[model samples]
Target: MGVIGLLMRPSELMALVKLKKQIGVWKRRSAAQEKDADWEFCFDMLNKVSRSFAIVIEQLGDELRNAICVFYLVLRGLDTVEDDMAIDNATKARLLLSFHDMIEEEGWDLHYGYKDEKVLLEEFDRVVRAYRSLKPQYRATIKDITRRMAEGMQKFTEMEVTKIADYDLYCHYVAGLVGIGLSQLFSGSGLEDQGIAQDEALSNHMGLFLQKTNIIRDFLEDHEDYNEETDTRRVFWPKQIWGKYTDKLENFTFGKNQEQAVACLNHMVTDALRHLPYSIEYLSNISDEQNFLFCAIPQVMAAHTLALCYANPDVFKGKIRKNLGECRNTHPVKIRKGLSAKLMLETTDMQATLSILEDAIDSLADKISPTDPSARETIEKVQLCRDLIVQGRRSSSPSSKVASTWRQETSKATSYVAEQCTVPLLVLLFGITAAVDVPQALGSAWWQSEAVPAKLGPVHVWLTSLALAFYSLTLLLLTRGAALSWCKALSAAQVAMTAAEVVFSPVVGLSVVVQALPKLLLAAMLPSCAKQRHSRQLFAKQQAAMGNRRVLRPRPIKADKSY
Candidate 1:
């Protein structure tokens, strides 16, 4: 994480909490449905192979969720074949060419991929079963993309990525195809319109941008994978771009070639930046809010990653940026725990997601918190007590994101309780007082009496009851999150009833004011606008997004059913 990335303030922390809650709600909803072994195994494989993707996939509406999940697994299964260096050239090419057909085949499992990826390969049949269960449109989308991606993978497996066009073409085959497939899946769900998938070039740009970022950051890993001994592994950094700086692509990672490497890195980042406007335009077309988040979360993260990657020499060293491997792989430059949550929470419309992009662009442009050359992040200390403070205590821990989130949520809950109780408490006090005063009007005591209406007149009887009931309803509704309009109208009714109490039957003026003061206070103090305008709009959208978001519980193959 960078300097600014460390401090996750209260709002960002809360966003993370809310995101977890939203995901949990989806999970619980999924759990409540009829799931069989095949469905269970598919989800297990999904969460196993893809980390961030599984979470995002689970949040989609029911119809498309299963299909998207299957789509991802199929691609992961294909990627495994592509990544496994142990597989000889011919057999791997055959597997890559036929991956789409394998998704439909019964009892099809392979054993040649890497560690965790091998799990996906071994039980590939379960994913095939789940894939088969999807709607025909979804199946067609997955198969079509898979077939194309497989052909691309097969072609690239033999050919080295030699030029910029080839790099873009390879990404299109792998990651760009994933983007197109997702857009098609979104359309199939009926959550988004067919128009969303209509612009194929725009969607492809989204994938290219992300895929290029991955290739840039993973330069070390991919370059290391570049072997003269093995013809199978091809380094994705196109020679055409890197060739401008050095004779060899791997030389970019060497300290002696630092300047050339940075120049090359900047070149790659600049290439990726070309697609930002296209990505922004793509997100602008997505109308469904959940689908927007599903797409935008990673898009925003990509921008943040680009901000970190641009002109930074760390990616060439490999440790700061973990490339595609296990599901746990994350770039240190990432938004971290609260980052995804904040983007998901704060990004209401496309405008907000663009604002994040704008911030990243600013960082790249040196507009915000420009990096200082003299500032060293880590210094070798010569002595312990050289600073101004004589006795500095144990280092003050930066506020924990989890702890800060917990405290903020607790404080909100406490404040919510206090807010809910305040008006209602006053209203209840006034209602009780007014109810007590009805018979007190008959007697001497008003503020002094504990009696109900015993000998009051018909007019006073109705007045007291009206006043009491209005107060009760106002308070009751307020605490229950009812519209303030209800309380506003009831306040008007209470005022009229109290005025009649004073007009006909109230013998004491002092008691009437005392008894009616709370409602009058409430009426005067009630907000003209209920909640803050933005908050109301944002939370309303969040409720719609989170509220019973249907995750398709495609039944587990309960019996020993096979294709």
Candidate 2:
């Protein structure tokens, strides 16, 4: 990964952890109140959802988890600022500034919102205390998350503009940075490069994906409670894309623009899905278990969002959550044996990007450390470390696009070898009864002549021909299998890309190329030549052009399930 790419991703992970912890503390604090049962339940569900993230941190050691936790705990203060409508703007500004001051001074005042301030405050205090108990590094990360939150809030309150751009920025302030943080953490794990640097673009897309999904899902409530007259409504749907569907989207308030919103929603999902495969490489590289939590939760959440988009409209009416019960019921158990791992290693493309994230989390089970900090400053340092790592990596190599191309090419080559193999085999079978048994004829070709060679008898020649035919037939069967595998794999990739219309424009006439034509050709071709490496290469070039290389981004694109 490039310097900023690594740094950007790490920031994403850190931001995500902070968000989750803040939510966790809020949920815990709110659950104590008798009147807020429903709220508590929602928070609890969210917390349950958060546990899936535990997989990321599972291997990173306690310092990383504490670092993340502390950051979120402190940032929860700022979230309280935005979430609590009762708080006046002036006080919110003061509190946010105070947080900024705490970062500079190395200490913070925790008494401002202690009593009747809300569950978040109490939860924040607890996390802060827990953070203070950790090592300095962890404490620093906590402080950093808080500081960033403070800075973000400062920007939010001081802003004179409220454009759709502002909402996008706000989402970034709130969530996009998390995407950046995670990318760093992922790089730290040191996986074989799957274009991690170029992943910055993908990372940004991922952040937008998650945030946009949130915005779409929360459109009704935000409009009801948080809408500002000065600001335009719902920046989640960009003007360019919305122009095509606005007429159809008019009345779709609570799941109103269900169809169109899903189209837009999928733009982000597919973006996430595109990068999601790298999580496997990341997990394989990491030695710590705690890191898994950071990886798994977001993946599960992303998957849940995708499911919601594809599901009923009720998902938009309220939070569509994947709770512990639901998650457990559906969760896949990783096949941990060497044989299974070996098999998995051979089929990286087949593994769902979602599984990559979960697997990263799953891999963290054996590596938890207890000394980690869950504070803001430490999280910030972690962010800085990530930034440093990305920078360092970038110093070694400059072009993300070129690197991505190499990785894609490598993937294609490996897939080709795994999918295709040429084996010679017989195409015909017949019994020949020699009229002149054991005759020695010199005129015609020995096998066809029903004659024995001068040195060997006719019987020996017949036996040799039979053996050659058997070998050829065996080779033919193997070749047929290999050719069939290559054809299927190639088509599958195309089908998947086409399905992801959210990420790429669909080729108007490529369906036949990826579908009917290849299969037809495979069936009609001579078995011996069908699996020829040259033929496979020629076909693969076309598949890569159609499936991997970018074409123009589709206008008003919608995701399909072509796969």
Candidate 3:
């Protein structure tokens, strides 16, 4: 789910049109035949979103649309099974297993004339037929994803209690895996190289981000459903974490536990943010038509939604949302801007954009602030860190070379600092041994003196020395890292600072440094003994110099290459 994905072919659209047309016809007929206004409304509501997807697909050439439509229907069928209460667990299990069997048995029947036969099995069959008709290359993608979905579904069991991990698996099965499939479609659509590794990362992460969003959004609904007197229950939130925070899971419903709910929402949002970069990268990889609606729309929607969620605290109010109008107006403009700015992805402006978007999402759950107090401190810190990183890159003799090297060296330095910090203190205890002293009679021959026992002396010294050395290294490493981190933080703060010229001018930088004097004084007042342990080592100077010089060097320039 972490990979970038390819595009679907142009020809695939034909199949999608056919399947959608059938679903449309089936909907009309069923609405008339069953006379169930509520049922029709439900499908219509779902289709409102699905139709947007269809429009995007239709715009793609037929070949891609056809394949996507089939996959879409198959997914819809699974969703129907999961949602439909009329069917027994036995039937649901059978249907889930049948999906896997259908992949191998091209003409296999998944629904087998069950309740809601027309909506589930009929639509599923149409997609299957369309899939079989696709060229072998497209067929292969469908088959692979279908198999993954089936594998994920078949693993579900009625006899066991559901775990958080299982819910994650379920998300992977239904949505994250689809993200992977869609990525492949995007890659294969003949837009660009659509490198497998990058696409795979995008595919997986996008799906995960979306799935996590759904979980966060659905917390209220899930909580309500879980409490119903039914055989099934929702346990999407991990019991360990939820139990630690609150006694009753029901408290998580929107109104009563808004703050707690938001905290849980934050956890999922944080998890999604971890994957946001990949989602961006994945969208960036897509070329032409597929990029617009498929890549751009969802990416922007999710981002805006995240921003809204962050800015507002009412997400627990049944169904908190940033309506479509907001998405419609904001996304196109942002995407237009994004496409142009994509080349300088690692630049400050780019980072600022991401930070802004993240803040926007977070702002939904909290109050929007021009100078939000909660994140102001963190923002300032990160700004300084990045600025130092940028400054270290710009300070070389030629300046241009420094500028060029800034990207490469700073990254290496930052990574080195982080990497060195992560090494365990135990690693420095490699060559330890132990011995002890004992008293002996003076008359005894020197050689026959009572042997000193081989106690844990050497070992203790080695361990203690190592611990001290590691502690020392950690302090030094932290100082340099903190300095670099501070540098970036200052750089970030400069943007948010009230007066840019004033902040960057000699006076403000000096003032900021002065304000930081307490921390600086504390750091300096700590004993110089921290760096003394390795003083006699052969390469101690070299190591210290190397570590020091890295901070003074340039950063890695991630060249913007064609997707």
Task: Identify the leading candidate in terms of lDDT.
Answer: 1
Stretches off by above 4 angstroms in model 2 are: 1-60, 100-117, 157-168, 179-209, 226-244, 247-250, 255-289, 310-563
With candidate 3 superimposed using the best TM-score fit, by how many Å does residue 284's alpha carbon deviate from the native? 2.3
- Every model: Cα RMSD to truth: 21.1, 19.3, 23.5
Report every candidate's CA lDDT: 0.65, 0.40, 0.46
Candidate 1 residue lDDT tens string, 1-563: 33333231455667777888987987776666666798898888888777778877777766666778788888888888887766777998888888888788879799866666788889888888888888999999999999999899888877888878888889888888888888888888888889777767778888988998877766666655533456433478888878888897657663447767777777677667766656766776687777887788788778777767766777766342323432222333444567667766666555456556655664454311112221111000101101201111112124433443464467556545545555756566665656565556455444443333335666676666666666566556655555443544554555556556667753566766775666555544433222222224434554464455343332211111010
lDDT of 3 by residue, 1-563 (tens): 10111011112334344545644654454344442333333344335436645544444454465567666766666665555444566776777666645744444444333334334454454445555666676677777877777667656545222355555566677677788777676667665466733545456666766776666555555544432235455446666445544677677654667666555555445445544555545544444543444455555455555544552445555542333111111111121222222211221222233333443343332322223323332223223334433443334346545445564566456544434433232122211201111111112223332233223244333433433453354446434533322332332232222232233322334655643443333233222212222222313443343343322233332322211
Q: Superposing every Cα of model 3 onto the true structure, what RMSD results?
A: 23.5
Which of candidates 1 and 3 reaches a greater lDDT? 1
lDDT of 2 by residue, 1-563 (tens): 33433232344445445555654663444334342332333233223324433333332443344345444445555565655444566877777767634534422344333223344453443444554555564455445545665667667665632344655566556665565445544443343143443354444444655665565555445434432433323234444344444543335545677765544444433333333333333333333333444444454454344434432344335532232211111212222223222222222221232233333322221111122221122223223323332333333334643554465567556545433422211222112212221232223344442222344444445443543453344445444444433433333332333233222222235543543343233222333243444345534544453354333321221222111
Instruction: Order candidates by lDDT, high to low.
Output: 1, 3, 2
**lDDT at 294, model 3:** 49
